[model samples]
Target: MPANTAPIKWAQRSDSLYVTISLPDVKSESITLTDDKLVFTGTSGANEYACDFEFFKGCDAEKSTYKVLPRSVQMFIVKAEEEEEEFWPRLLKDKAKEKNQVKIDWDKYVDEDEEEEAGGFDTSGLEGGQGMGGMPGMGGMGGPGGPGGGMGGMPPGMDMEALMAQMGGMGGMPGMGGEGGMGGMEEMMAKMKGDLENKGGDEGEDSDDDDLPDLEES
Candidate 1:
């Protein structure tokens, strides 16, 4: 048969070889092969299917000879099936959850440490103005005589402006003498003018004194 016809099914029986092939749209026919090459004598279809059976070692129904087949032909017969699972994805999710938990615990520990460092000291039963050893602005038991006691001595309804002026003077700003502190830019300018006038008067007095020559009857 020619190469374009339908495929041929070869079956091997004890001492004979039987070949059955379907002809076009008609019935199939069985042919006996006496030699290695089998030739078709009658024509059944326009296309002919033929192949050389010299290498077809006989087909056995009970024993499969696929292992003895050529590597290229064996590759086309065996198929591999793959199995998929979600093992890695679940493990990754668990690891991420553990990491997030660790981060939360770390943040909580840092916040607790910050609070303890800020002002969480045990200061109960201690008088409001009493000194707590080595702590600045505190003094022993008796109230109001401590280092920061001025805050306790402010008189009722005291003028804030006067207090600030006193503080400014103690803070050392030029020209703001004693209790009259930092008298704005206008006050500083006025003081400067007065100083210049005094200096000018002193110079004038020195000039007049120079004009009054030496009283030595020269």
Candidate 2:
């Protein structure tokens, strides 16, 4: 499964670096921070998001902290050495990889469970003796409903199993999985995009406004 790519906004202060990523609905417990990297998974609107950052400047992960907001996450990372003065040219020291983890909410942060679950469909009304009435108006005859209700009038056969399986496959597509897998796809795309950009850079492509420039120690 591809991880969702999350866009980031960051700034450096004398004491710390503030890194924020748009994530309206994130799996809070999914957030992880270490001396070298940071990672998390989340969603916004109809799309999903994810991010993995490997820092160039060493950071004190123990002193770092983050807050999950209604639509974003704000993180603070303390400098490894208070006296050192330097700023990062880019958010990551190297190409990022999607290393995803548990996606439970803060309240259920300790639980090990699936991030998404199907609410389950209701078929009781859809399963009486009339049994689905042959594609709506096709209920030709036989029962009080007419030929549309008859056994011979019924379609060849309702392969519920096959149909359900096919539907499940569709649900697994991007933006489809009740809520899980689709979110990760964004991360995959983001990573691929980053790779392409880096490749172009390797080929001597000109840098643009989109590329972050080196910062002078202040």
Candidate 3:
């Protein structure tokens, strides 16, 4: 008897496709890839499953990769031609083949413009080895391979734009005048000194007034 066709989910970016096979604890598995096709077979317990996908266009099989997770097999497929990257309207070359076995992976999906905006931000300049002079660990908190690394030390699912805006606001604080760093301390100290001098002058004026003889029935 022929093996059953395994169910699959998929999402895509401009240059890559993310595919997930919903077969768990596979005892054996086989995967084959070419410029325009993918073939998969696996066994779990007594059940055998298989699937074949004819891609909408050429793919770079050499650069693609896959991983076997506890509950799924995840695959990342790259487009053959990076210079002409674009999202395929559908995953399969034959539209009719996109039937019950395949579905959209909405959880991993991002539209073209959204992906562009997220990827366009250049973060190289933000990697200051010493974050906020007095704050240790802050520099390495969100660094690559560090804690909360992928999200830039931010809580998971936090909006990047919102975080950046918050940081910008911090730069305006009394002791955070320059790029929200330690330089603000100097500005705050100077302002405090001027305030103290003004208060001293006022006190001196009051003292002189007190020294004047009281007006006698003027």
Candidate 4:
């Protein structure tokens, strides 16, 4: 009997491709990689699992790496072209081949712009940049706050303006005020209070003016 074909999940960046085979506790693993093809065979207890892929573009097989985890085998294959900076439209040379067995790895997917931003923070010896590190979500969560110009770890969907209105004041959060201090919050709260008090005083003055209206015509 033939070995069972393993399921694969893949995602990619401009320079590399990620391939994961879902085979638990694989032993006697054999991986054959070339510029265009990858063949893998392994045994999990009595069951044999295998998979093969003909890549859409040339790859650097010698520089590629793989590790067998408790539940799967993960491969990181580097692209061959020195100037490659675009994602391949399809993973395989034959577009429809093994379509049912392969699927996108959405959790690992990063858009081109996000990848570039992540690349900018890469250190000399860091493996695959900070974005691709073990804590992948850290790159998307921007400096001291949420991603894409949010305030102080605020929930993405919360409307700050509405929230302040409900609370009956407009107060500046820390760091949102001038150069990071409690000063902004203090000023904002004071301004709100002063406005309310002044409005009441103006109403009282208007009532006094109404009582003295007899000299208005003179």
Best by lDDT: 3
Q: Which candidate number would show the highest TM-score if scored against the true structure?
A: 3
Name the lDDT value of residue 172 in candidate 4: 34
All candidates in order of lDDT, best leading: 3, 4, 2, 1
Q: Model 3 off-target regions past 4 Å?
A: 118-218
Candidate 3 weakest lDDT stretch, 10 residues: 129-138
Tell me the tens digit of each residue's lDDT in model 3 across 123-200. 233332222212212233455433355554666566877765665565644445665453465567889999999999
Candidate 2 vs candidate 3, lDDT winner: 3
Q: Per TM-score, what order, best first?
A: 3, 4, 2, 1
Clashes of 3: 1
- lDDT assessment of candidate 1: 0.33
lDDT of residue 137 for candidate 4? 20
Candidate 4: Cα lDDT at 143: 28
Candidate 4 has which clashing residue pairs, if any? none
- Quote the lDDT for 141 in model 4: 33
Per-residue lDDT tens digits for candidate 1, residues 84-108, read 2111111112454323321221211
Q: Report the Cα lDDT for candidate 4.
A: 0.68
Among residues 3 or more apart in sequence or in different chains, the pairs in candidate 3 whose N, CA or C atoms overlap within 3 Å are 175-184
> Which ten contiguous residues of candidate 4 have the minimum total lDDT?
128-137
True lDDT of residue 145, candidate 3: 39
Candidate 1 segments exceeding 4 Å error: 1-6, 24-34, 41-43, 55-218
lDDT of 1 at 205: 75
Query: Which scores greater on lDDT, model 1 or model 3?
Result: 3
